[model samples]
Target: RGMNAYERLTSYWPSYDSISPEARRAYLQWLSSGRKAPHANIGYVFLFFYGLERRVFVDAKTDQAAAGDIPIIIAEVERLLSIYGKNNSFNNYASRFVDFLRQGQILARRYQKAPPAPLPYGYEMPVELRIGLGQLAADKQPMPADWALAWVLSDHNVGKRTPVTRCKEAFAQLFCMRYEERYGAGMVLPQNKTRLRLQYNTASAGLPPQELDGLSGIPDVTATSAARKKLQQLVDECTVQLEPYSRYLGRNPDTPDALEGLLQLPVNLWPPTARTALAELKQRIGDGMVVMSFGELAGRLQSAGSLSREKVLTLARALESLHIGIEPDVLTGSRTPKSEDNVALFATQADDGDLRSSPAYSAASVTLDLACAVAAADGDTSPQEIMLLSQHIDSWSHLSGAHRKRLKAHLRLQLNQPPTLQSLKMKLEPLAEPAKRVVAAFLAHLAQVDGEVSPAEVKLLERVYKTLQLDPQSLYSDLHVASSGSSVGSSQTTPSIPGASPSKPVGGFALDQERIAQLQRETEQVSALLAQVFVDDKPAEPDDVVVEETVEDTSSICGLDADHSAFLRVLVSRTEWSHDELEAVASDMELMLDGALEQINDMAFEHFDMPVTEGEDPFEVNPDIMDKLPL
Candidate 1:
């Protein structure tokens, strides 16, 4: 469609408001699309024009336009305000319109001119009227009857007014009128005994003059005999609807009985509607009953079978508006305050650190257990060990006092039944590879916690290395660099063992003379045995024997256990080992394998019919038998 006249005018002037009748009609038709505008800016434009319409009404009232323009302005203002009343931004503009109209009435009264007739009631009139009349009554002026009746008829006032107040004014007016028609006006009670008299007296003290004016001429009655049951039912329903707010109001002391006090607070700082609803409730239910009802509702909502998400959210929001702190878990139906404290007892390190789901709690638990095991391995748990463990526990700030105590106690118990290497490895196996490396590093740290690593601690660390399938050489190097007070992973020389003089370097590592000599003697012995076995044999290819079979056969021949045999096999298979190093391992096993090698040598010589000669070797075996042998 082509651009409307209003759209064209706005495009050029931006703030243009003085449009012709046709343009104004086009604008109104455009706004009638509600939220379906082609662009969001159109909605803003609609609000602007709507505001201008309200300004027109103000001008008409100012001029005291009695007939033609006044009615038209009122109808247009009502239509615009009703369409956008729920919008906070629109309400802000409408409030100004209401203020202007109220000010005009005050000026008319001041000049002794007759006040204009009250504006006709429309859908958005009640809240706007209530606010306007409230301000007028605050100045001690009597509010008009038509204005107050319009407020009472507005069903949107449910949470804004107390059941008792509503019953007296709105319900009483309806019931009294009915009764007067059925039983005649003379049958009505004396003025002082009538419900209307009581309501007017109470309202006159608290309500604006406009609200009181609306109650002026209703027939007074002491009781509505036939309508009592229905009136009571309406009162009960209103009380039930107001129950949540009433309870909230009774809990605070600053503004106990009045809902208006809450409404007067800054809109951004408080839940205005909720607090007002609560205050209205407190007025009808009395302080004690409201408090009791709130407790009952809270209890029911907390229970498993009775809990409702909607009710819980409403109650929580209400309490929050009052600045009352509530645990979110309670609203989520997860745990009560007491239960939450109890749950802290079993919290893992991740739980204590406020890391809800990143690190697995099970992994943390296993890590803790391994640390305790390492600490206990040294016969006695020292103060340094305890302090280190305490430091680790302290990092988990989410742990409760009871939880920390229990963990410490469990660590003490673990010292009595210290976990075996295999058991510790089982725990560590489930951890990720990085976690395993970290655990290994921590164990190394624990061993050197007392300034020096004891032989037993070093031995235990070696066992851990084997059990966890970690590199012992790398771990040893790391621990040594750490103990030497050098930067880790740096190319620093290895520090000499405590009380041992620095000796000659073997493959760049310094070794004690005595240890070097022992190694040399073992190497010689291993080479001599290998010479006897392979002396008369054809050179066997490295690929002739399977490494797996060689390892198993070597274990059986040397009478060693499977684990030790595997260890030895791994050392032999490593390409990094020097010839002397390989000889040393073979030499270490020579004593146990002596008889087995001798029997094999004898059988091979017999089967081959090879005779011993003076110049030839007597211990030489057949090449085939030597090839099949694992030695």
Candidate 2:
């Protein structure tokens, strides 16, 4: 419809008295002769639209061209302006005007060659447009027509508040081009970055011009106070809704890097809030610190309420990369050691001065928990995997004084091997059962983030359960018991109800006779057994306290049907101990590591001992023990 109107105005406007003779003749001849209707009039209209629409509509009588005739009038204006400069005026003003026309023509031609694809009706302009125009306007000389058009669009008087939107978009396209130039067409932003970009573009909105300036000029002190308040409020909100995903992925490693990468790409391209956070974080981490632990930074990002969840994760990734390691000389004023362990320790030292409570520990714990939570959400319980995850926890924890020195020395060693169960058990197995449970609980908490359990996670849980001598199945089943109990207790503690009969239970009987009796009879027995097996003797055998449903022979017993994968994932991610280290851990509680090893070996041996009389897929056989096996 707009195009149709424009065409009608372009074809009819030659008859108007405001048009020049030369332009009128050109238009009439083009129209009467009908030589494909030369687009010169259309071009004129475009220029006029660009100029007149840029200013305020001060009055109805103002020289604002009708919307339909804007383009044609602009082209006519350009042509006449050129003529006036070349023939009528010769003084300094004329010279300057000539220069302006030339520039405007170049910009217009460039625009014509590729006028920005028309923006959606309510779309904001990209950042590139603003910065590009700003750069162009920086010149002392008068701007050309196109540059002037850009300048006017960016001007404070332009009623629209989103000039930056255009600038942002423009900058993004420009950055994309620049990125492609450096990294090649096939290279793409990291997944986190891509996700964040999509999210930022979608959720972001522009303010009115006045509001925008207000936000932009938000004083640091004011911004800081607001950010801190927001952060506190958000943290409180998170306390209740903090599901496994929120706990694990809240300050996830994957998020913050994507955001940081975007911020680092170009300052002028980022949103004001994003720019401010990035700038502050950069200052905190130091300009040279590109690669960092997302978990570490996020922990220190106490004033992170200003950041979106996605942005927080993006920043995490940026800090985790080795390429962005902090410069030792700048931070701690020292170079690192040569050994892998030493290097790791040195890296910690280089981060900050404090050892017991450095930002590095905060980062490591958060990221590790996030990783574990992500794994557990999958819900595959396997012991072997848990053992592997434990090693990471052990390796990461206890980074004070001598421990810190030990880790730095080992930092130089290759960490390329995929974490394994034997390795985790090796380091974590030596810790006392209570200590192991603490570490295991930490891992479990992390795994619970996603609300599912993996085979590796099961293994970690099994090790902890066995060491503590608690029933793994019962524990898993009652996993939500802790949270549920807390909720109920809170409700029961309330003194009164808003609109209830006084005689009836206000908040459902402050837990007196019936409920206590039922719980005592049902749960007490199990709890006592658990206390005997886990808390007292710390017995390793399932048969000692765990009730068997079937089977009689104690020696030729079938293996415990519990999953161990969860334990394994947690174990491996936490530490890096050797097999002997694990064996020692089992030994502390009188659980013979050698016996467990033998059982695992026997389980493997039992698999191949079966007869295959008929032709079949050998691998199709199930490895579980048969129901009526010889005892």
Candidate 3:
């Protein structure tokens, strides 16, 4: 029977491991002479050979032994293909050879394990082959010197070993070929040991090494050790140069553990050009060209506002290293300053006389002063009071943790020397108009923090209102207090100035002399009645006659005469009396008077020849009221 395709292929190509050396040599000779074979069968032979070569190349210990043989195989294949002309058979073999070389170059780079021996002598290489090997070595995947030497020795009947000097020369030639391929062809190889050492050291460092023109002789053991030490010294110098930058950046360079932690951080955590910029900044600061503290510099960086205690301590160390003076109380080595000294320092810093020029600073200072004053207004500072004050400050300002801590310290110091009302007012006077309003509202809020505004707190708030030059009614309105009268048990009120009107006109009506006197009497009566109401749990109801008299008195005080007063009295008598019954009756009477006033206004407008719309009735005509009129 005829052989099948698999059998035919296997017959022509025995397993590579099973092939005898003589048979392989004879086959290569015939292939080089252009003897045609089945293209598929020849391809299978080349593939099997490449697989065997791959195994030998990948084994580190034996790879150097086989490296010398690769070039011979490549050269023989090239000779065969040149004679055979272009065809699938030659193409397949050529492709496999190229693939093998590529993989070997990659393995050389990945391992970076060059053999101790160099290339052997007396093997002439084609310019194309030299250029290919040069390109591979220059691609950062250095071709192993011993590997190239072995390849050069492949076709020759040389001994197992070669002279190291001759090998070095061959390796140098290969490297030069690569260098010429990369740069232009006319450049000479660099022969200076100093330049080579520089390139080597620079490559060992983080930066890309400049290409050296030529290889100097390899150094002996003592020379190599010395070179390594010099390289390490350069590295140390670089680290020392970075010390100022890290210190000014709030990183502790002295602490090895801290530096190691910094190294492990992500790239973006340390911004680009930050070290250089900070170094320049430090130089500027040292020269007195820029005046700023380390803390202020760190405050401008990202994630610096929320620094941890450890980081804060590290920042202190860094600042010390830079010789940038920090306030003794602001930060010291790992621990916070002593409480008393810290408080004193904070108070002094915050209360500097120059704060008057800065509205925000003055406002903060006055706020702390007022808080201390209010806290002690009722004789002592309670924990609840301190807590309430803290919350108020937090809500009012966007203060960092360090600033807040300093403020707390200042507050404690202020409690020792609470300012008088006049002093506090003077301090607060520099605040802007909007800030003054905020302070007024804050004081009012603070007064009611204990769930009830105390008499002392009310008195303090009143003083503040006047001191701040704010309207008392507006202050009370902001506090949501009842505007009709002062709060119970408190003496706060809109006090009348000496030359000012005794009574502010209500509803745009001027009070005559009698009406003014009557209004004063009624105000006193209301105050007395309110005091009574608060004293008794349930106030006793006044008799009808007394209620009628009170209603008539209030009406006349409000500028209404006898007829209108009688109408109000009738309205009050019809409603059941309560503690605030007088107030309710007064409200109703005011509404009725408003309508009557409107009718009078319309009639006056008509008299003045102003047209009035037909459907618009300014007043409701009450027949019962009209009939009761004296006219």
The whole-model lDDT of each prediction reads 0.38, 0.31, 0.38
* Candidate 2 accuracy as TM-score: 0.21
**For every candidate structure, what is the RMSD over all alpha carbons to the true structure, in angstroms?**
44.5, 34.3, 43.7
Q: Which ten residues in a row have the lowest lDDT in candidate 2?
A: 193-202
Candidate 2 per-residue lDDT over residues 108-128, each given as its tens digit: 112223223222221122223
Question: On residues 180-245, what C-alpha lDDT tens digit does candidate 1 reach at each position?
Answer: 444442121222211121110011112211212333333222121222233333434544444333
TM-score of each: 0.24, 0.21, 0.25
lDDT of 3 by residue, 126-161 (tens): 212333333333343443433343333331111121
lDDT of model number 3: 0.38
lDDT of 3 at 330: 30
Question: Judged by lDDT relative to the true structure, which candidate is superior, 2 or 3?
Answer: 3
Off by over 4 Å in 2: 1-11, 14-311, 321-467, 470-631
Q: Which is the better candidate, 1 or 2, if ranked by TM-score?
A: 1
lDDT of 1 at 448: 58
